[model samples]
Target: MNILVTGGAGYVGSKLVPKLLEKGFHVRVLDWFLFDDNIFKDLKTDKLELIKGDLRNSSIIKKCMQGIDIVIHLGCLSNDPSCDLDEELTKSINLDAGINIIKEAKKNKVTRFINASSASVYGIKDENNVTESSKLEPITLYAKYKADLEEFLHSQASEDFSPVSLRPATVCGYAPRLRLDLTVNILTYHAVTNNKIVVYGGEQKRPNIHIDDLVNIYLLLIDAPKEKIHNQVFNAGFQNYKVIEIANLIKSVLGPDKIKIQITEDNDHRSYHISSEKIKNTFNFSSQFDIKDAVLDLAKAFENDLVKNPNDSKYRNVKHILENEDFINNKILG
Candidate 1:
């Protein structure tokens, strides 16, 4: 099967694209190469095709849909701060461009369309666990767009076209295109590089998944029967941890004495625990890696110098967008 992975050079996509190729699926990547153009440079596979273009361009998106059997749509201005940086650009990419991709996929006779949604769509839930059917309370522009796209995807699902939305947890662990902005990753980076980390409003709970497990869930969806997942929404989260708990985990992994944790107060209180029981009960799928495992993996990566500069703005999406005025004007605005 020929699969098209939009944003295939991104944090999760860098890990996922190679796995799809290993599974013998001919993969084509559509991305603007905003972060790192050489993310897949060492993947010596004939089944890989790279298209360096933005998803907002209808012409580029149409060209990407050619001969595509499955569409793994992961392209967007991912995360809250990044989306907040430019709401117009975020809507253009995450909502408008996403709709264009789905419409083109249906037109091109694509069998499966898997959307990479976020658990943040269930923003600031109460003490109860948020399921797929729970009321969506998107607090950020990013989460709102994902929720909108999820609704739009359900509307587009048909007998011939199967659309599945996977509301994935905040992904942790190392990827080829490494990201340091995520909670676990940022804490780990500070523990390794600075020997200290700060926890702001550390009691807020957040759902998390190992990057590998998150990638595997997408793989499973590719092989799952259409009848089972068609027009269905599933949350793909494994573990839930408070911000302080995650900081402690990093401290334990790197060495308690080697790292210092300082708790601070912050007004940003976005917290939610998602339940993946529906997907587990229906498809027999569950995450294998836990928070400790993810922490260790990142620690090993830092120790091996795999991630040379974790403090670089390029590794942090929000920082990169904020600092680079030209990127905002030329790449995002244009």
Candidate 2:
């Protein structure tokens, strides 16, 4: 199978593209190549195609969709902060540009359109087990865009065109292109580097999944029966924990004595939990790695100097977003 993974050099994509290659699929990575420019630089493979282009360009979208069997649409202003940087830019890339990719993919007869949606679309849920059938109350512009695109993708689904949406939780773990901005990662990074973990409100509960498990689900979707996945939306979050629990988990993994926890008084209301039972029942998939694994994986990666300096600007999404405002608004948007 031939696959086109948009934003294929990113944190999840960096881990996924290589696996796709191992499975004997001809992989094409269409990316802006800004954040992870060094990720796939040394790869010398005949089966991989790397195209550095903006997704907003219709020509680029059409070009990438050419012989693609599956389109893993991971490209976008990924997080709430990144999208909130500029509403127009976020909508342009996340919503408008994404539509272009789907149009071209459907036009070119791509079998599967696996959208990388966010579980954040559920917002601050009071219910314990928020399933895929729950109403979407997107709290941020980033999530609103995801909900909007999911609407368009489902409407576009047809007999030959299978558009599946995976509303994934906050992913955590160590990847080739590691991110320190996530809850688990940043906490672990602080524990490893600063010997401290700070929590504003320790009671907030957030759903999470290991990067490995997330990648495996992508592979499963690639090979799933069309009937099972056509226009299906699956919630992909397994682990649920409070902010303090995550901080303490990091403390346990990376020297509890050395890592100190400082909890400040604040009402941090950003808590969300989701049920993955539907996906589990559907794909016969279960998570092997948990919060401990994510912490240990990141700890090991830092110990081996794999992520030599987690403090680097490239490792933080918000850092890059703030620094490149002009470039993103002009060049990337254009």
Candidate 3:
């Protein structure tokens, strides 16, 4: 099968693209290469095609849709803070650009159109586990757009066009293109480098999944029967942990004596415990990696110097965009 993974050089995509190649799928990547493109250097096999361009470009989107059987749309502004930076830009890329991709994919006869949505679309929920059918309460601009896209895709789903929306948890663990901005990852980084973990709103519950498991879910979707996945929205997540609980796990992994935990007030109060039972029951899909495994995976990455500078803004999505405002502004506005 030939697959097009938009934002294929990103945190999850960097790891997923290679796996897709190993499975003997022809993979084409559409990315701006805002971060390093070198993540694909080692895996640049004959089956992999990397295209550097913005998703807002129609010509590029059309080029990417050519000869594509499946379109795994992972391209977007990503996190809440990053989308908050520019609402207009976020709407263009996340919502408008996504609509274009879906339209082209359906027009070109693509079999599967898997969208990367976020569990943050649930916003602040009660202690009960939220399912895919739960009411969506997107608080942030980022999640609001994700929810909007999901609704639009659902409306467009048909017998020919299989659109699957995955509301993934906060992805944690090390990827080829590492991101230290996530809760588990950021805490692990600070614990290793600064000997302290700054945690905000210890009581806020955040759903998390290992990066590998998150990628695996996408792979599963590729092989899943059309009847099972078509027009279905699944909340993909493994475990739910409070902010302080994640810090404790990191301390446990890196040694409690070596790491100190500090609590701070956080402005962002969005929290929800997502349920993955529907997907698991339907497809028999369950995550293999746990939270501790993710912590240890990150620890090993730091030990090997794969993450030399965890403090670098490039490793953090919001920080990187904020630092390169002028460059990003030109790409979006112009």
* Alpha carbon deviation, residue 17, candidate 1 (Å): 0.5
Report lDDT (Cα) of residue 221, candidate 3.
94
Better of 1 and 3 by lDDT: 1
- Checking candidate 1 for backbone clashes, the offending pairs are none
**Model 2: per-residue lDDT, tens digit, 1-334?**
8999998988999999999998999999998876877797666789999998988889878888888899999988888878887788889889999988998999999999999999998989899999999999998999999999999999999989999999999999999998888999989888888899998888999899999999999999999999889999999989889999999888987887878999988867667789999999998999988889999998899999999566677888767877876646556532
Candidate 3 off by > 4 Å: 265-270, 325-327, 330-334
Candidate 3 lDDT over residue span 1-334, tens digit each: 9999998899999899989999999999999877775778887579999898888889888888998999999999899889988788889899999999899999999989999999988888875789988899998999999999998988888888999999999999988898988889888888888899988878888889998898889999999989999899898888888888999988987897878999998876666788899989998887899889988988899999888666778898988888886545847422
TM-score of each: 0.97, 0.97, 0.96
Question: Model 2 residue 269 lDDT?
Answer: 67
- Using TM-score, give the best candidate's number: 2
- The list of candidate 1 runs beyond 4 A from truth reads 323-326, 330-334
What Cα-based lDDT does every candidate model obtain? 0.89, 0.90, 0.88
Ranking by lDDT: 2, 1, 3
